[model samples]
Target: MERDRNLMRDILLTLALILAIDAVVVGVFALLAYPWLTFVHAPIAAVVGTTAAPVARWLVVFLPVLALFVWAQLRFTRQELLADVPAGDATRDTHPDLHARFVRLCKQADMQPPDLAVVDRDVPNSFAVGGVTNATVVVSEGLRDALSDDELDAVLAHELAHVKNRDATVMTLASFLPALVSDDRKILNVDGGANLLVWFVLTFVLYLLASPSLPGALFSVSSVVGFVTLVAISVLGGGIILGVLTAPVVLLSRRLSESREFVADRAGAVLVGDPSALVTALEKLSDRGFELPDTDARTHYTGVDGLCFLPYGLDDTDASTDEDTFTVETRSHPPTHERVANLRALVDEL
Candidate 1:
């Protein structure tokens, strides 16, 4: 019954967050469209001496933005998949036993077996990547070395749960708008150089279109003031717009991520019929003091810290300080103690 309740909660939370992210993306589109509608298109229409319907103008603006959004989604998805593939030296092709174990686990979980790889890192971590058909499960060398056979099976089950749930795809889709806005901001900045040359050209074209009707010289005081004001508004308004659209989506994504972790834990525990093994795995992974090498640490943290069995570098204990409390609250995974307790309760019920 508790499992069912958690399953329901996960469904509800996932739906809510997905809807929230959709709304945010739509809101950003509307915000972006307004400037084109009121400023750019209006001026263009005036110059053309034709009044286009508001709906038509909105559609014109919306189509391109929608195209870009789709493109970004595809681009990010591909990048994530590529990122999941092990480097040349990190491949686990020689480990047929591990591969067979993963295949067996997938059969038990009723999920298609994901491609598997082993990272050379000693971080004792694992993560899942890719969409449903192309998903891959990556485990660290340190993790395989650290855990017992049952514990390793439990960890694999956990990663398989992520693949089965399609969490990576869901997360990527949820993060689409944030990524787009961030990347667009970089493109809009002058410092982006050759990469944003097309944007600069577009800006130049707009300037040409707007300048013809103005009375003052291009560098006149009035023109300078107008340009500065426009820049200020773009900076401030863009910040506000991005913040409003991003904050809720990001927060909700994080919440959904945490909820998914719980669901995965439950699902993985059931898959193995050994919640205690998962509990032991989580405890071992949590308490392991292995530090990632400096060269790989940043990439590891950004890539798979959230997907790991436990929060990286954090002990399976209650937060002792105010800062520690904040860190626990903000972490992608739930506190280890809570997760262990939950698994223990689940084991008891089983």
Candidate 2:
């Protein structure tokens, strides 16, 4: 009950944060593109200082547009991926049995059936993408060949839990803010930043030119301080805006992802009614070395790798060291050893 409540809280928080970030992104875009809508008819105030009203007004108009875009993108992208890659032949080898068992598990969890795809790649991997019932569950052929029925069911249930929880879409939406902030940084550098730097330098030159003519030291000091303060505020404000805009989205995404992985692991175990089988699968997969052909070192492993049954690829500790968790950071999936340890602990608890 506690776990379920926490999950509910996380889901609500995730939705709220996504919606907030969506609004912020739209507002920022509109403020950038249409300055007049937000502009106030204050000629005297404008002459003295630029008002923030125009920026505020632009945000009000952009929120709905951005929300629609996010929904449409997630909806259509899932359909396209599913259409291009038809469901794997359940009749092919053990996949059919795996599919039947997975369906049973989904039903037990009260989830609508998710589309499943099998990849012929050598890596032992599986990923769940999409939201609600429109989810896609993908597994590499290597994964099917590597585990027993119960173990496979556990893995599929884990992936299905991801679908039931709508984790993929949440993560994608969460990531949008960071991407937007990063892009906004570029825009500020190109537009706001460049202009400010030019003005600051020009103002310094002008002050120096007029410095000799000032009648008092107080006037000179005040002039220099005022100019420097203006430049400082511009840079600081832009950076603050960028950080404030992205932090909630990123943090919420991470929190939801972490929680969902744990929930999925438990749900998967229950789905097969065999926590030990899931444990066995995790142990086996941990021993099997895996690597993606072209994935970058920074690729997110998260839940996808958290349930894998083995370590993959050649035993080269020095291959990739950029991951936050130095052990499993080499590939898309998290480190097999750590995952195995965690699962074993989870099994003991159950």
Give the least accurate 10-residue stretch of model 2, judged by summed lDDT.
307-316
Kindly list the per-residue Cα lDDT of model 1 for residues 244-293, writing each as its tens digit.
76767766666777777888888898999999999998888766764423
Q: Which parts of model 1 are misplaced by more than 4 Å?
A: 14-18, 34-52, 78-93, 176-193, 196-199, 205-232, 290-301, 313-331
All candidates' TM-scores? 0.74, 0.59
Instruction: Compare the candidates by lDDT and give the number of the best one.
Output: 1
Over the stretch 97-120, how does candidate 2's per-residue lDDT look in tens digits? 667776788789887777667766
Candidate 2's error at 228, in angstroms? 25
